[model samples]
Target: MIITLTLNPSVDISTTIDHLVPEQKLRCAAARYDPGGGGINVSRAIHRLGGKSRAVFPVGGATGSLLEQLVAEQQIDFQTVPMAGWTRQSFVVTETSTRQQFRFGLPGPAWSMDERELFLNTVLTFPKPIDYVVISGSFPPGLPADYCAVIARIVRQRGARLILDTSGEPLRMAVQEGAFLLKPNLGELASLVGVDKLELDEVEEAARSVIQRGWCEVVVLSLGPAGALLVAKTGHADQRIERFRVPAPTVKKQSTVGAGDSMVGGMIYALSQGKSYEEMLRFGVACGTAATMNPGTELFHKDDVERLLNWINQSGKKVFLPVADGIN
Candidate 1:
């Protein structure tokens, strides 16, 4: 089973105004509220893709209750750990005239030391075997970077693969502990490799470097509209890696809020179904691109994903794999 852990989940509120003029009481259309955060959104996207995943997060206060109700409405199974402070809320406003979007986020409440132990224990003691454990989103206040390393150890002990999507020191710690898969954008990739910048051609080598260091078995580099590149080990002692690239299909763009999470959902779901690496990347890109077709924190629809996946399969974009430059 797939289990997603969102350390700092939020209730997302989105609305659109005809014009976003400053110093004016501009009216907005009716607002839409949804459960938000990296892992939570991944669970939602997995559900939309006709898959199941259990979302695990801490909830507190009235806003937390609202978040639970919203997640329930999506028909996703979840488990929550109680927190002393309230869950955070995120706001998204779109200017209809200019097609511009503005997002506001609040920091999550701090977690006490006791609370941290309980949360870690809760994850470590899941009743059933977990096929994949996805730890996404930001670290809540007072949650140290090493907590990610602790999580990595838990996944290892449980014999489950870990899929990580985060930034900064937490990301570094988690990578140091090793993971099955990592979804990092270009900027995050550059950071992981200790570089200031990375050109398009430099991406493959940078990703493979992470694999060579035994940090992760697979690195899916998210390149936004340019699509994604996958660098993974072939599982032989030779330390050879295979690479594949897929371009994002053009669509009427909306909001890019949950596209990365959607991509994670799609890829993990495909992996659970025993799909090939190329198929997984295609589905992931399709789900991510399809998510851009909707506004606000919404994920992709099943129909849209299927259509986009078919398009990707027929687009004739070649999957590039060079001769094995065996890891030293």
Candidate 2:
């Protein structure tokens, strides 16, 4: 089974405005609310694709109750650890004129030491072995920076694959534990490597270096419209690290919110089905493209994913870059 752990979850409210004028009171044309966080988004995307996965999260107060109801309405399996504080809410505003999105996220509720211990113990008591344990999103306040690293250790000790998709200090600590997969966008990767920014060549070197240092078995650096690069740690000269550049599809991009999370979901869904890395990346890219066709954090449906996959396969223009020997 696939399991996703979201340390900080929220009720995401998304609204659409014809144009975003900074100093004015603009009326929203449309709006929607959903349970959101990186890992929850992953679970929702997987469910949309007819995949089964459980979302494990911390909840508190009325907001948390609402989030639980929302998840249930979507038919997602969720397990929660109750907290003393109220859950947070986030706002995502999409400008229709330019297809630009702005997200305002709140600092989540603080967690007591006892609450943290309970969460860790609950995670340790999974009823069955999970195929993949996805640790994603920001850590709530009062949580340790090494929280993800500790979870990674637990997941590793249970012989399960760990996929981390996060940023900041938690990401820094988790990398030291060496997860099975680390999916960081270019900016996040740059932060992990302690650089202000990276040029294209620098990005490649940083990704490869992460793999070489044993911080992660595989490093996937997402390049937005340019697609993603996958670096494997096998170190075989003939084993070329694959780069899949998904040219942004020609569509009315209503929103880019949750596109990355959808991609991760698609990739994890494909991997859970025993698909090859190449196939997984292709499917993931398709899911991301399909997600852009909508207006919010809403993910791609199964039919949408299939349609996008068909378009990608028909295009037949994927580029493959061979890894030079002895580079590591």
Best by TM-score: 1
Summarize candidate 2's per-residue lDDT along 1-328 as a digit string, tens digits: 9999999999999988888777998999667889999899999999988899999999999999999998899999999999999989999998777777889999999999999999999889987777999998888987888888899899988888899999988899988988888889888888888898889888777887787777876777777777677766544555445444455456667777788889899999999889877677778888887888887777676787788788776775545443444443
* Per-model TM values vs. the true structure: 0.97, 0.92
lDDT of each: 0.92, 0.83
Per-residue lDDT of candidate 1, residues 59-163 (tens digit): 999999999999999999999999999999999999899999999999999999988999999997887778999999988887898999999998988999999
Q: Which stretches of candidate 2 lie over 4 Å from their true place?
A: 18-30, 97-99, 234-244, 317-327
Model 2 quality (TM-score): 0.92
Q: For all candidates, what are the clash counts?
A: 0, 0
In model 2, which range of ten residues has the least summed lDDT?
319-328
Ten contiguous residues minimizing lDDT sum, candidate 1: 316-325
What RMSD does model 2 have? 2.3
